[model samples]
Every structure is written in C-alpha cells, then in structure tokens.
Target: MPSRTSRPTRRTALLCAAGLLALPRLQAAPAKKPLPPPPDVWPRPALVPGGVARLSLGPSATRPQAHSGELPLLVVGDAIEWTALVGIALAAPPGEAAITVAAPGEAARRVPYRIVAKKYQEQRLTVSPRTVDLSSEDQARYEREREHLAGVMATFSPAVPAQLHMQVPVPGRRSSSFGLRRIFNGQARNPHSGMDIAAATGTPVRAPLDGRVVDVGDYFFNGGTVWLDHGAGLLSMYCHLSAMDVKPGDQLRAGDAFCKVGATGRVTGPHLHWSVMLNRAMVDPALFIDA
Candidate 1:
C-alpha cells in the first residue's frame, strides 16, 4: 500500500539505523587486540651463603618478567629499556630461581652473562722488604683508613643513569693472573678481588663514569686508595696510586684523571687495581667494559 518513493525512503532509513548500530562495534574491535606474549623463563642455581643472585638481561626491547614464590610476577617496561628485580625468597633453603624475559620480536640474539657471589675466606700475605710493616702508630692509621673506606662504601649509590660507562684506569698490559689463586711464601691468599693493569710508575688513572669522590687515603694494605660513589649503590675504586689528584666530595666525569699508578699495595710492580661494586656485590669489571 506504500508508494515506491516511500518504500525506498523507508529502506534507506533502516539501513542507516543498522549502520549506526554497527559503527561502535567496528571501532571497538581494534581496541580488543591481544596483548603480547609473556617472556621466557629460566631457572638459576641456588644462591651461595651470604650471596644474592645476579641476572643479566638480554638486549631486547621487550619487557621482562619476574616472580617471587607465591607473589605475582612484576613486569616493568619503558621505551627501549627494561629491568626486573626479584627478591630472595628463601631464608636458607636450597631452591632454584626462575626468571622470564620476553623475546624481542621473535629475533634471535646471543646474550652474554656473568654472575658473582660473595663467600668468606681467610687470606695470608708475605712481607716483602717493599711491604710496609706498620708500627703501632701506623697500625692505628691503617685501621682509621679502613674504617673510612667502609663508611664511603656504605653511602654508595647504585642506580646508573646511563648505560654503564667504563674504561681501564691505566693504559697497560692486563695480567692473566687476575682472579688467580695465590700462595705467597707457601701461604694461601684470597682470590684477587680486582683486575690488575700493569702500567708504568706514575701513569695517570682516569674515571670511567660520573661519580663523587668519597674517600682518598693511603693504607698499609691498599696504599693510596680512592673510592668513587656512582649514584644508585654503585661504586668504583682505584687502588695503589702514587698520587690522588681528586679530593672527597669532588664530582668527576668520564675519563677524568683521578690518580697515578704505583706499586703501593701488596704488589710486585706498578699497577692500578680497579674494582666495581653493585649493591655491595663485587662483579667482573669486564662485564661492563668493551674489550
């Protein structure tokens, strides 16, 4: 009973109403895209006594995942950087730790890793003619110096603002004896705590990153030692210096000269003993340095 024009008009109105109703769903379909896949998880060996676990993150843009026992895993990501922290779950138990990291867009890459743990040991050293034997007065001086060193280490900050900037403090031949077991005069000693760079006497030492000079002094063991506090609980140390050019509280930039190499500590010849600490844990400086 409807006219042809009226029928066409009614059909057009119906089609327009249906289109209006479907528009919201079409817009929402894009919003319902599936999230990215979770990262891969790996289990680590049990932690050593008085030691914490160390994790090396792969160079990937994807976020990382970490779970602590019954607690939910925390995954944090930023534009191109990602990091995760997993607290020690066991008080003194022997169990493995699992860490998961997301792959970067399905691409394969070789990731390097190094882990260091603290252990207790007794060390002995031979008293060479060059070794400074402390008198009672000198002994007091050494104790005071060590206490100051501990204080400086306590105030260190660990959060690195930029990629870990590092350099060999002195230009010299690296000793293969680094981290070696030593038996001096038929007595065992602790493994070398730092890398030994053999350089000529009075060779200038430089800072590897921006930091604040926290302690500088001569001791019976370390000789002329300098400790730098890089913010975020990170620290760098220069030991056995012939001279300390920087004073405490002074700020330093990368490549800044801080000392001159010398055989001041328990050493055979002139060298710079450079060490790095992260969250009170000593790690291999090679991990942060380019070969």
Candidate 2:
C-alpha cells in the first residue's frame, strides 16, 4: 500500500515517465502551405494553342533550365521561385504536353501541362492571280527567303527582356487578327500568323519593345522586313514596310520608329504586319499587348 502524502521513489517516477513515453503521442497536423499569388504581368497564361503557358518551378539555388521538346524554354524569376514561359505552337495538338526541367545537381524531371483547343475565324480576300500562282523565279526566291527566315527565327540571346508587354507599333484599326485562315482568289492559303494594322503608306512604325535588329531584308512575301531579337527566345517581326530606318545589329528602344507602313509585299493595301515569335513558335501578338 502507498501512503497518500508520500512522494513516489525516484525509480518509480522514472519508470512511470518511461511508460508514459511509450504510449502513443498526438501530433499537431502539419501546417497547410500557403498558396502562391497569381502573376501580375503581361503575357498571361492561356493553356491553348498559340498561347503562352506560365509554369511554376519550385525554388532552386540556381536558375533552372527548361525545355519544350528540343528547343530551350525561357525560365525567369529568382531563387525563391522560378517560372518557365512555354509558347504553345498554333499547330500543337490539344492534349498532354510536358517540359523538361533540369536543376543543378538534380536529375532532370518532366513537368507536364495540358493544352486545350481553340478556334480562329477565317477570312477570304481577292488578290492578283500572279501572287497566288507564283512564277518559277518567284517561287525560287521565296524558298530562299523561307530558309533564311528560319535561321533568323532561331535567334536566342542570353539576356531576357525586362519587360514583356508590348506597345502597338502603328496605332490604327486592327485590319486582321492572328490565326485567321485566308482564301486568296478561291485558293486556300496558310493562316495569317500576324496581327495586321491598317495605316497609311508613310505611317511610322515604332518598336514595341527594346530589341536588337537581327535581320533586315526585302523579302518577296514579307517585303522590307525588320526582325528584332528581344533576347531569350523572343523575337518580333515587322513586315510590309515602305522604308526601313534600322539595319541589322542596330539596337532599338521601345517607341522608336524603325520603319514605315507600306503595301510592299503581296497585299491589297498599305498595312503593318507584326508577328511575335517565342521558342520558335509564332504566337498571337495580342497576348503581349493590352486590349
């Protein structure tokens, strides 16, 4: 029997404490992780063809490298959180798509995302029969230009542009929207890959963002074209210009007039055709501009 007022012996107390330790203990549920805030910038996420997808890659000590297929993607942000801006091709099928992320000292992993379908409007126009049915000489010239433009489009510099939003180059009514299919003289042609702005022949065309002139040429189809490399995998093209003020390797700031509107190429009238390319994909330029 134990006395009510007597203290337990040291050995008994120790044994009791040990027994208590052996019993199951309750733990507070792990604190819920806070959700990340939405990105407050241009080029908002649109998980569809011809759209830009913003993928969040968890924190890393160094900038992680990401790629969509073989082409490297543009990864931005700091050590706390990095994000990959993936440009979905207009021809990309609506289904599961993934990008490869490689962080320093870690095995590369695949980050998967989904692409939904989108439909664009169709347009038909009447142009010269000769423009639709090209001559042999003109066809050869077009092939050469196409091959050269492919190399220009593949330009990728190390520095990424600080600003993503672009200003309208030539302020006017939007003549044609992007991804518009066209029927020229009853012959089906490729979908319009750019946003066309209706302006006068001498209307000054300005740079939408800071970039370096990569290629300046008078293409058969594009005409007095100027390609600006905006660093990383982003590039912009201004076509059908009456005059080009900037040459290759020239640096241009936003709002600087680099060319003038014209009907130099195969067109019905004077207009500026602006195209934005990312990761070798011609995405909708409207994505990088304000409505």
Best by lDDT: 2
lDDT for each residue of candidate 2 in 152-254, tens digit (9 for 90 to 100) = 9999998988889999999999999998989999998888899999999999999999999999999988888999999899999999999999889999999
TM-score of each: 0.59, 0.86
Candidate 1: lDDT of 233? 59
Candidate 1 lDDT over 69-89, as tens digits, reads 333222334646544433232
Question: Which 10 consecutive residues of model 2 have the lowest summed lDDT?
Answer: 2-11
> Which pairs clash inside model 1?
157-231, 157-232, 157-233, 157-234, 158-231, 158-232, 158-233, 158-234, 159-232
Q: What is the C-alpha lDDT of each candidate?
A: 0.62, 0.92
lDDT for model 2: 0.92
